[model samples]
Target: MSVDRVRTAAAARGLEIEIRESPRASSLEEAAALRGITPADIVKTLVVKGRGDQYLFALIPGDRSISWPKLRALLGVNRLRLPEPELALEATGYERGTITPLGSTRDWPVYADERMTGRRVSMGAGAHGWTLFVDADALIASYDATVADISDPIETIR
Candidate 1:
């Protein structure tokens, strides 16, 4: 049902996408291998909290991490924080790892890193074992996303 919701959302936008399913793996590297892509190609959809209970989806490449300063400056706000897992599910109707802007409970603003553009990116498909292969340009245009340099290389990444 989750993946179906994603398909429906994409269809409504007239954007073409390919859904790929793989066995649930133990780590990002394992998941990438199962999907026949490098970890960097895997886009991580994050549910972030802004002021006054507001939320936004932050799309970052799997190998990079969100830069709080960069994101805050781009968002023109003083504070931005990530929601807890439970709150994230409530905000997006999907678990942390399966969250996507495509079929979210609310069509909140989407902020994607500039690096994601002009590439064949793999993103979450509303299910842990499923992923969506999409053209970065089409996906961004379909969502009217705000593309900017909101991420920086992780130093001692967690």
Candidate 2:
């Protein structure tokens, strides 16, 4: 199972995490309420396509979304788009909402929005209805992710 792979990876890295079941939540808002955290604390994992079939894993706060301009500038790429769902699953070994960098099939490059630091965030656990509650800094460091300002609040953007 994907969640088991995630747990194995965490153990190999000496990181401890708790996987919370969230089968009843129908939306991000509801999930946050169930997790007892503010909506902004949920982290969304996005799979973005770059030039020549390259892909990147972007971590954005649930209340915000990617800023293409900033991401392109940071990546020095001219074109980037969210891949079709099937392609994402093929690349990450986890379905859309359950994708996480922790146990991806490939250790694709990771980037995190600067805002997530020091927050206790809920992110997908590689399974439906499950989320991993983790310390942002610990997660980022464990994954060796590049942290940068690459997103804007959803309302502020579009």
Candidate 3:
């Protein structure tokens, strides 16, 4: 049902997307490897809670992490946090790992890291054991997402 929702949403936007069944991986790197792509090509759809009941979807590359200060300044807000899993599900109609703006129950605003532009990226398919692939530029246009440098490269433990 969730995947169906995703399909319908994509169709409505005239955005072509590919949904593939995948075995759930334990980590971001592994997920990318399984998909035969670099970690950077995997986009993470994160739910960020703003003030009150407001929330937004952040599309960050897998090899990066949200830069709180940068994001705050970009949004002109002093506070933002990742809400609890239950709250995320309630907000997006999809669980944490399966959350994508395409099929969300609510049309939350989307913010995308600039690095994700000009590439085809894989992301959540609104269901477990599935992945959705789409052109990042098209997705940005489809959602009217704000594109900026709102993320930092993920530091790896040496």
Candidate 4:
């Protein structure tokens, strides 16, 4: 049903996409390998909590982690945090690891990492055991996402 929602949303936006069945993987690298793409080609949708009842989606590459400081500056907010999995599910109608902007119950604003531009990227398909592929540029344009350097290499964060 979630996939159906995603499909409907994509159609409404005239955004072309491909959905594929995929096995669960233990890590980002494994997920990318399963999808036949590099880790950077896989985008992670993160639900960030802002002020009361406010949330936004952050699209970061699998090889990077959200840069909280950069994001805060971009959002012009001093505070932002990731809500618990349940809250995220309630916000986006998709479980963690399967969250995508498409078909979200609410149309939260999207912030995408600049590195994803002009490339094909794999992302969650609003359900487990599935992956959605789309043109990053089109996705950004479709959502009118704010594209910026909002992420840092995962190693730097670690």
For all predicted structures, in order, the TM-scores are 0.93, 0.94, 0.98, 0.97
What is the per-residue lDDT of model 2 for residues 1-158, given as tens digits with 9 covering 90 to 100?
A: 88999898878777788897877577778878889998889999999888766888999999898999999999888899999999999989999999998888988899999999999999999999799988989989988999999998787435
lDDT of each: 0.89, 0.90, 0.96, 0.95
Report the C-alpha lDDT of model 1 over 30-135, residue by residue, as the tens digit. Answer: 8788888888788989999998779999999887899999999988999999989999999989998788888888999999999888888898899888889999
Pairing residues by index, what is the TM-score of model 1? 0.93
**Model 2 stretches with alpha carbons more than 4 Å out:** 156-158
| Two-way TM-score contest, 2 vs 3, winner | 3
Number of the top-ranking candidate, with TM-score as the measure: 3
lDDT of 4 at 67: 99
Candidate 1: which pairs clash? none
Report how far residue 68 has shifted in candidate 4, in Å. Answer: 0.3
What is the Cα-based TM-score of model 2?
A: 0.94
Worst 10 residues of 1 by lDDT: 149-158
Worst 10 residues of 4 by lDDT: 149-158
Q: Is candidate 2 or candidate 4 better by TM-score?
A: 4
Ranking by TM-score: 3, 4, 2, 1
lDDT of 3 by residue, 31-113 (tens): 89999999999999999999999999999999999999999999999999999999999999999899999989999999999
Global lDDT of model 4: 0.95
**Residues 1-158, candidate 4, lDDT per residue (tens digit)?**
89889989999999999999989999888988989999999999999999999999999998999999999999899999999999999999999989999999999999999999999999999999889999999999999999999999887434
